[model samples]
Target: MKKPIKNLGKKLKPCPFCGRKMVFHKEIRINKYGKQVTYQYYLHEDYDIYHDESCILDEIDMPFTIGAGDANPDTGYIGEYAEDWNRREG
Candidate 1:
C-alpha cells in the first residue's frame, strides 16, 4: 500500500561509531487496509549530508512506536528491536 511522509524528531542517544549525536531522519508512514502505521527513523549522520550514511558502517533497525489507532485489530507492527546489533557479533 501507498504511504505518507512524517517527521519523527531527534535521536534519543549518541552515536556508537564516533560518539556523535543521531537525529530523527524520516517517518515512514504506511497504510494497510484501513489502518495507518507510522515509523520514526533516525539519521546517524549530519543533517546537511544527504543519502544514508549508516549503510557505510552498518545497517540498523531501531525500536519505535505506532501512532494511536494506526493499527487495526489483526495487523500492524507486531514486534520491535534495538539498533545495537553491532555489539552482538564478536
Candidate 2:
C-alpha cells in the first residue's frame, strides 16, 4: 500500500493568476457500498470571493486515481495535483 498524503511538512504553491496562497483539501466520503472514497483537490480562496460561478476557477479536483476506491498515502500524488493547477496560465 502507498503512504497517505500528509498535509504537514509540505509547502503549497501560490496561485499563478492572483498571487494568493493555495490550499489543499481531502474529503473522505463513503459510497453506497460503504467504501471510503477520497476526493483530493485544491482551491484558491481569494479568487473565489470576487468571481461568479462560471468565472470561478478556484477548485481543481484530481481527475485520476491509482485504483478503485484506493486510498493513496503518497504525498507527491496529491501535491502534483495542486502544483499543476497553480501553474496554469489562465
In candidate 1, which residue ranges exceed 4 Å CA deviation?
1-11, 25-28, 47-90
- Measured against the true structure, the TM-scores of the candidates, in listed sequence, are 0.34, 0.45
* Residue 3 lDDT (model 1): 25
Estimate the TM-score for candidate 2.
0.45
Model 1, 29-57: lDDT tens digits are 65767666555444444433333544334
**Native-to-model Cα distance after best TM-score fit, residue 40 in candidate 1, in Å:** 1.9
lDDT of 1: 0.35
Backbone clash count, each prediction separately? 0, 4
Worst 10 residues of 1 by lDDT: 2-11
Candidate 2, residue 69: how far the Cα is off, in Å:
10
